[model samples]
Target: MPRKPTKGYWVRGHFVAYGSEEDSELKRAAKWDADLSKTDLKKRSAHLQAVGEQLLTLKPSLLQGLDLPPSLREALAEAKRIDDFEGRRRQLQYVGKLMRQLDDALVATIEATLAEQHRASAAQTERLHAAEHWRERLVADDAALDAWRELEPDADWQRLRALIRQARKDAQVHPDPAPGQAQRKGRAWRELFQHVRAVLDAHESPSTVARP
Candidate 1:
């Protein structure tokens, strides 16, 4: 750690701890206990309090045009609830922009937070993919389909139903193929398999791990 700068609030050559005050008015409070003599502490405390309030009040306005982390800015830009209205969208955008300006040091904080989420999401996605493949192989051998059916009965049933439906439809639509030929063609089964796999893929979570 570098020595605290004697000249200004910012250390000229070092990174200070987060939320450190620029002025030393607040230092007295840290130096002495809050239960000290009221008269002695009153003057310094009052001035420091006033300065703190003023700094906070002006800080937001000052930060209004500062740049933010690109990832954070992009995330904020893309923030939209499922049922978000246009007005709410605009409000969120304005809020995000304002926040970006005020908290100049928040870029790192926001990125770190998002990185954690990304890592977790990635882990979950990996787990889901593993589950899908394991189930598929299991279904292929002994009871692979049975395992899938047990895990996701609705999805499994729907896939089977769709394949049967398509087979019937194809048989009716195209009279060229023989009766059992259409069923064995496997196009309908292949389509249903592809569709089910796609649905599983869509449910996969993206990795949120931070990269250098």
Candidate 2:
């Protein structure tokens, strides 16, 4: 007769025989988990549920890249269509359960993706601010042109200088009339902003020149 196979479960690609030391140790760890207070478990559940909810806000492109299980993805999609508050809550709870089943590596990847998106958004806002600051400085200070030339050596200096000069003249002629009046900036001011933004964008490869 063929030998009987060992009664065991595979863990981390190893067969853990039933009642073996490794299996006993694993059971002990589980016992510790079982001993956790209900309050602690609830808190952990709530945190995981919140992370699951964040998937709804994720961009479609980013969401598609995640290696989520079919059941969890389906649950999330259904949750979005759920108009009833109670039903949606229940669906999301299901989502949380599925999230808990995800391997730590996948969870880490999700966190990293969210962080990357956040950083990109912040960098875009910073770039816009830098362009605006440069435009103002270029108009107010003549020496700012030389500074800008150093920043973007290949930029068309003649057009930039003309735009700056016209922007300054327009500001002097049409100052912010009063607190209640609309902020009326001339065409040159807007053009200068566009120019600065273009230069900053073009320079991102060699070096980021859009600093305040």
Best by lDDT: 2
lDDT, residue 194, candidate 1 = 58
For model 2, where is the 10-residue window of minimal lDDT? 203-212
lDDT of 2 at 145: 78
lDDT of 2 by residue, 1-212 (tens): 99999999999898999988667757754764798777876776677788899888888899999988898899999999999999998999888877766666888888788777777777777778888888989888888878887778887778778888899999988888888889888999999999888877766542466554
Question: What is the TM-score (0 to 1) of candidate 1?
Answer: 0.29
lDDT of 1 by residue, 123-177 (tens): 6566556544543353335445565554355675755655656755654655556
Alpha-carbon runs more than 4 Å astray in model 1: 1-84, 142-212
- Provide the RMSD of all predictions against the true structure, rounded to 1 decimal: 18.0, 7.8
lDDT of each: 0.46, 0.82
